[model samples]
Target: MKVSVVTLLQESNVENFNSGLEVLKKQTLGFDNMELIVIDQAESKSEEQIIELAQLAKKANVRVQHDNSLKVEELRGKYISFFDFNYSTSPHLYKNLCQEMDKHSVDFVSANLITSIREDRNLAGAEEVIGAGVHAMTGLKLINKESLLKMAGENKIELSDSFIELLNVNFYLRPFTFNYVNKQFYRNKFTFNESYVNNSISHIRYIAEHVDLSASKKSVSLMKVQLLKHLTFLLDKNMFTDNLSEEEQAAAYDVLRNFLGLVSKKEIQSNDLDGYTPLFNMVNKKLDEEATHYIKLLRSKRHWYEQTNKYKQYFEKNPYDLEESLSWKLTKPLRLFNKWSIEVKQWFYKVFLLTLAAIWKPLTFNRKIWLVGEREDQAEDNGYFFFKHCRENYPKEKVYYIISKDSPHLYKVKKLGNVIYHSSLKHQLYMLVADTYISAWTFDECSYPAPKEKFIKMFGKQLAKKFTICLQHGVIIHNISPYLHKDRYNQNLIISSSEYEKKIIQNTLGYSDQEVAVTGLARFDNLHELSVKKQILIMPTWRRHLFKINKSNFLKSDYYKA
Candidate 1:
């Protein structure tokens, strides 16, 4: 079987590249069975320089690709091996790995790596075993191209070490065969680099996201132990102080903050490997003494709701006694007032909406209606999409937009001549004049009440004469509440994405097939038409109760980071 050896060359380190190429040429598997593919990732290299490198590879009977692209789409090999230019493999490594694989049906194999720290290669470091061949990167094994491609899907192979490790971890999590060889099959050149700290912490996040912490508890625990050891080693060697510049130190501090947040997870918190506790205690002691200023800074930036040792003790003893704690006791009156104000305001708004309905009953249904989203958010969702379409299609008809005073889109909304912009305070007047009322969220108080700013006194019953529509935010993933189907206030129309969603809305909102429209989400109409970029935006919702009770802890959480 043919084995493809792939190496990515990023820097202009010709000496290291030649060393790795020489080792590949000496593989015992023979040139006929093994093919080398070198990917040139050095963007600074010109066409002439790249051609020279390609010529050198060609002379060694190895294929060369000069593009920086990592999409290994058309690779020709039964098994693919990834290697680094700074690493050298044993001559018999592939031959032995193939022999071992034949004895057992395995998907991947890895061996211990001998690391040399000195330039002379005289002083050798201990052999490092990188987990059960799953977390292995430098000394990684050969796997079938089909299997690797199947797992990778459309995700491009990123140059980031953390991203590459995440891909490997994902592959290992699949129910596939994996093995570890005791022999050292590769030699890695160890060098001190400040960037390694960032890469290491990033890998920790990848492990947390992809690994099933419940099933692989031991693995995660060991990783945490190893990470702590690695950090201590870096600190002892003065890697953070001597090597990193001022800007680098600030960047490293940000990474450290993120790492601390990851370690605070429930699964990671429960595990404490042997020797880790002593190291942590020592570090804490050192930080308390030498890093007093840094500790003070951290405390200043921390949230008010974050519990301290004293607060924890108070919580354990007092439990339900809010008056027992100084902080809680001081805030109790304000909290009570806030609670009372919300109920009283909601009551007043309900009555006001009913009064508006009385005035609206005698007025004619104005074909020119208005639409707005929940709160002072942007005009990007279903409501905005539908509003834009209506204004463009029927220019003669009046389409009003009730924008929140604090909305960032206020300026943009004002520029649209076809659409009239009004503040939320004038919503009751618009409700009286408009024939239709459209919103992304539920308008009825029994379902989803309007925010304090957008409160229109009218309930569902009062707007019975108008064409009321609830252009829902998104498809429902969970079971819909039975209260929605009752439609106590009377929503005349409900929009759904598909027949499946329509059925769910029908069952939950008690709306028949005729009442629900399957016109697809209007917001997604021009999504494909817009220019896309190679960037990802993650929008995560916050827990309301958690923010209210433990705002400090919520601010420090990964959800807030996302």
Candidate 2:
């Protein structure tokens, strides 16, 4: 009963707080020893409206006060608990927390926050008080004011910061036991706003100040990893998408720079970073100031194209080091093995396959031997549809679809005829004689038995005579020029589903007019007669954290579980 529930109120959440007052009136804890303090911060409300709201709170025996500062000492209750109008809580949360606090004699009792009932699969609570710094600050917690004041005094943190101060108290002050009440008393409904930019800065500062680099190395690294992931999300979701002002963008930049400065380069260079490696590496290399200026230009409506060109010029002047990239280092072994395998395959083809070329040469002489494939192992995507088209329409064209014999989708390809096993002698010979190579991915798919570079080098004139068509897996929306540019993948022709997509490919990917064809996706051919169903389909994009991870590790990822 000696619990004082404190909540901050503003004009935006006035109605929400009014509803919350109704819930407080129905609390199991009697109002005689309990008090609800609503600190009003909304400036638009008139004096009459304030009085009416105070009278309404008075009906529930709650006190409404207008204050610019928080005076923790003025609280009459032995414990102070922070609550928000954005969340829904049970009537017995206060009573249950107080009971646990009394029984365990703990300084604070942390309750579970089930944001989504479905996401609370791992209901096993925190095993250490350090975990309180994470879950406790965001969710429901009842703190003994005596212990809080003592901790704040010893740690030299003011109570005015509220949740941030409480977070510091949780981390810095030792022997402050936090008992976790294994019950879902709260459900989160808070949406992230620009305030998140400032709040994240505060959390980053707290970690930098409190987490010892040498003593808690693992904790420090793990915290940095988590913060970097958050910064990446904030960069993509809020900074780029939200119409933030220049000052807000600058603040977001500072948050990123502060994180980069906190963690070492080795740490930054080791993680996958969820497609944020280039941005992080660029900032880490002291190009932060220049990059910040150019990045701001990208957010501007009027100066986007002009500023983007300047940004690209700057990037070209200072390109990222591939040897220093995380992906490059991680794939070094695979790349080396691939190179060695290519050398062996080319040697065998030159020594053995050329001897049989006399007989195979007769079959492909002035003929249209079309070779088709999707991936090295699978037969799906645009390749399958286009191959199906070729087999049904051009029966005498000698069309063959390449697929690994071990593929699960091999049956799908075999159902249509002329299936060639990938990496076989016949597949390698087919690549050499084929007049046109069609693929769903890159041009490299056509040269699977040997490396694309090796094949081009071994038979430059022959490759020139032959043509490679890219039936792209999907529309080109993102700037993936580094992978598809003319300097990277040498496809004779690139198919596009739309003129806009073709323009993006031409302008961003450095392709010429003759190279890109405005052909809609082949999969759409089947959609003409397809019936609409009374169902919804949700297709989330791929998560970078799961990339290159083994099946076992991927199955255990938080992204997978979520």
Instruction: Give the TM-score of each candidate.
Output: 0.42, 0.45
Q: How many collisions per candidate?
A: 6, 0
Q: What is the lDDT of residue 226 in candidate 2?
A: 54
Global Cα lDDT for candidate 2: 0.68
lDDT of 2 by residue, 461-525 (tens): 65667788899988787667677788878788999999999999999888899999998998779
| Residue range 33-143, candidate 1, lDDT tens digits | 776777776666656666768676765446676664555565666777777767777888887887766666577665556441212222111112223222342346667
For candidate 1, what is the lDDT? Answer: 0.58
The window of 10 residues in a row where model 2 has the poorest summed lDDT is: 123-132
Screening candidate 1 with a backbone cut-off below 3 angstroms (N, C-alpha, C), the clashing residue pairs are 353-457, 353-458, 484-509, 485-508, 485-509, 485-510
Task: Please report how far candidate 1 places residue 123 from its true position, in Å.
Answer: 26
Candidate 1 ranges beyond 4 A from true positions: 12-14, 43-52, 56-63, 71-73, 115-138, 154-156, 195-225, 264-562
Tell me the deviation in Å of residue 502 in model 2. 29
